[model samples]
Each structure stands twice: as C-alpha cells, then as structure tokens.
Target: MTSLMALVVGVLYAAAIYMMLRRSIVKLVIGLVLLSNAANLLIFTAAGLRRDAPPLVPDDAQVPAGLVADPLAQALILTAIVIGFGVLAFAVVLIRRAYEVVEADDMHQMRDTDT
Candidate 1:
C-alpha cells in the first residue's frame, strides 16, 4: 500500500509540473489541483499506514494505545485541501477577469501589454 501511494504521488507530481509549464490557464489550474492532491498524499504517507481505528474512546471502556490513527495529519491535510481549493477558485476567477479585460485568450499574449 505504501509503495502504491508513493507511486501515485510521483505520478501526480510529474503531471502537475508538466501541466504547470504549459501556456494555458486551464492547464495551470489543473496542475495546481494535482499538486495539492500530491501534497495531501505525501502527508498521509508520512503519517504511517497503520490500521488504526478512530480515536473515539467509548464510555466505561478503555481502548488500547496505538489503536488510533494520527489525528494531526488528518487535520493538516484537511486544512491544506480547503486552502488549495480556495486558491484554485481564486486563480480561475482571476484568469477569467484577465481574459475579459485584455480581450486575450492565450497566456503568451497575456504576458505582454496591448501597447
């Protein structure tokens, strides 16, 4: 499982980097999303893939140690995902506004002014 996760992370990183190099706003957005997923996967991988149950302790019962997944990683990943989604949304909006203001649809042209 760990190896599979590593492989997925590698592929995701590669795809994200390649897309980011392209001169299309849409592609850049996709790349950013993929990169975020890759980062989240990385965090999960680092948290140890133990088959731990939820950290909920039943009343009048004591669960043994080492039986709960690392909550910190889960929280971190969730926060990163939300932040990445917000960034992606903002980037898309910015791209659309740029296209409308400049009457341009290509990235290369956007890099230059209409002067």
Candidate 2:
C-alpha cells in the first residue's frame, strides 16, 4: 500500500508540473491544486500505513497500547488542507480578475498587454 501511494503521489506531482507548464491560466490553478494534494499525500505516505488503534490512552494507562497511528502527520495534513483551500480560493479570484482586465486566458496574451 505504501508503494502504491508513493506511485500515486509521484504521478500526481508529475501531472501537476505538466499542467502548471501549460499556457492557460486555468490550467495553472488546476496544477496548483494538484500540487497541494500531492504534498498532502506525500505527508500521509511518510507517516506510514497501518490499521493500529487510535492514539488514545485508557484512564489507567500512561500511554496508548500497541501500535498507534501518529497524530502529528494527520494534524499537519489537516493544516495543509485548510491552507491549500485558502490559497486556491485566492488564486481563483485573482485569475478571474486578471481575466476580466486582460480579456485573455492565455498567459502569452496577458503578457503582451503588459506594455
């Protein structure tokens, strides 16, 4: 499962880079979204895959029994997801405004108007 996830993450990163290199502004946003997702997946994969009990302790126990999933990676991924969503929202709004002002979705066309 870890190997499969690693492969998936690699593919997502590759796709994100490809989309980001496109000339369309919309594709760039899509690529950004993809990139963020890939990062989250990478973090998850690095945390290890297991069907362990949740990281909880019994009232009498000082620590969780047996293997427990790490919470730090989950927290990090959650934070990243929220931040990524915010960034994506801002990027969408910025792209919309840019499109309205430049009247073009192509980066080349937008660049030509910089004069």
Candidate 3:
C-alpha cells in the first residue's frame, strides 16, 4: 500500500511540476494544487499508519504504546492545506482579473498584445 501511495505521490508531484511550467495561468494554479496534495499525502505517510491503535484516548485511560496517531503531522498537514487553499484562491482571482483586464486567457495573446 505504501509503495502504491508513494508511486502515486511521485506521479502527482511530477505532473504538478510539469504543469507548472506551462505558460497559462490556470494550468499553473492546477499544478500548485496537485503539488500541495502530494505533499500532504507524503507527510501523512511519514507519520506511520498504525492500525492496531486508535488515536482517540479516554479521559482516564493511559495512552497505549504505538496507538497514538501523530497529531503533529496532522496539524502540519492542516496548516499546509489551509495555506494551499489561500494561495489557490488568490491565484484563481488573479487569473480571473487578468482575463477581464487583458480580454484574453492565453499567455500568447497577452504577449502578442504588446506588439
């Protein structure tokens, strides 16, 4: 399972990087989202998926060994997800504004407009 997840993460990351190099603003934004998901998945994997132990603990029960989920990684992933969302939202708005102001969606159109 881990190997499969790692492969998926690698493919997603590669695709994101490739898409980010495109001249279009939309593709770049999509690439960023993909990259963010890949990073989050990688972090989750790093925390170790222990099935034997439940993450939740009772008020009076002592925490069992190897049973606690790494809340730190979860928190970090949450933060990353929020930041990614903010960046993605900003990029979308910027792209929309650019489209309205420039009257074109393609990068080539904008470049040609300067001539």
Candidate 4:
C-alpha cells in the first residue's frame, strides 16, 4: 500500500508540474491544487499505513493497546488541506483581477501587456 501511494504521489507531482508549465493561468491554479494534494499524500505515506485503531488509550492503560494511527500526520494533512484551500481561493481571486486588468488569461499575453 505504501508503494502504491508513493507511485500515486509521484504521478500527481509529475502531473502538477506539467500543468504548472502550461501557459494558461487556470492550469497553473490546477497545478497548485494537484501539488498540494501530492504533498498531503506524501506525508500520509511517510507516516506509514496500518490497519490500526484511532490514537486513543484506555483510561487505565499507559498507551494504546495495539497499533494506532499517527495523529501528527493527520493533523499536518488537515492543516495542509485548509492552507491549500486558502491559497487556491486567493489564486482564483488574483487571477480574476489580473484577467480584468489585462483582458487575457494567457501568461504570455499578460506579460506582453507590460510593455
């Protein structure tokens, strides 16, 4: 499962880079979203996959009875997801404003307008 997830992450990263290299601003946003997702998956995979219970312990026990999921990875992924959403939202707004100002979605055209 870890290997599979690693492969998936690799594919997502590759796709993200490909999309980011495109000339369209929309594609760049899509690439950013993909890149964020890949990072989250990488963190998850690094944390290890296990058929374990939640990271909880009985009142009398000093530790969990058996294998337990890593809470830190979950927290990190959750934080990353929220941050990614905010970044995506900001990018969308920025793109919209840029389009309004330059009347172009192509990065090349927008750059040309600077002259």
Q: How accurate locally, in lDDT, is each candidate?
A: 0.87, 0.95, 0.84, 0.93
What lDDT tens digits, residue by residue, belong to model 1 across residues 1-115?
9999999999999999999999887788888889999999999998888787878777767874557888889999999999998998998898889878877756787755554
Clashes of each: 0, 0, 0, 0
Per TM-score, what order, best first? 2, 4, 1, 3
TM-score of 3: 0.81
Q: Return the TM-score for each candidate structure.
A: 0.87, 0.93, 0.81, 0.92
Model 1 pairs whose backbones collide? none
- In candidate 1, which residue ranges exceed 4 Å CA deviation? 61-66, 113-115
Predict model 2's lDDT versus the native. 0.95
lDDT of 3 at 70: 72
| Candidate 4, superposed: residue stretches over 4 Å from native | 112-115
RMSD of 1: 2.4
lDDT of 4 at 15: 100
TM-score attained by model 4: 0.92
Which residue segments of model 2 deviate by more than 4 Å? Answer: 112-115
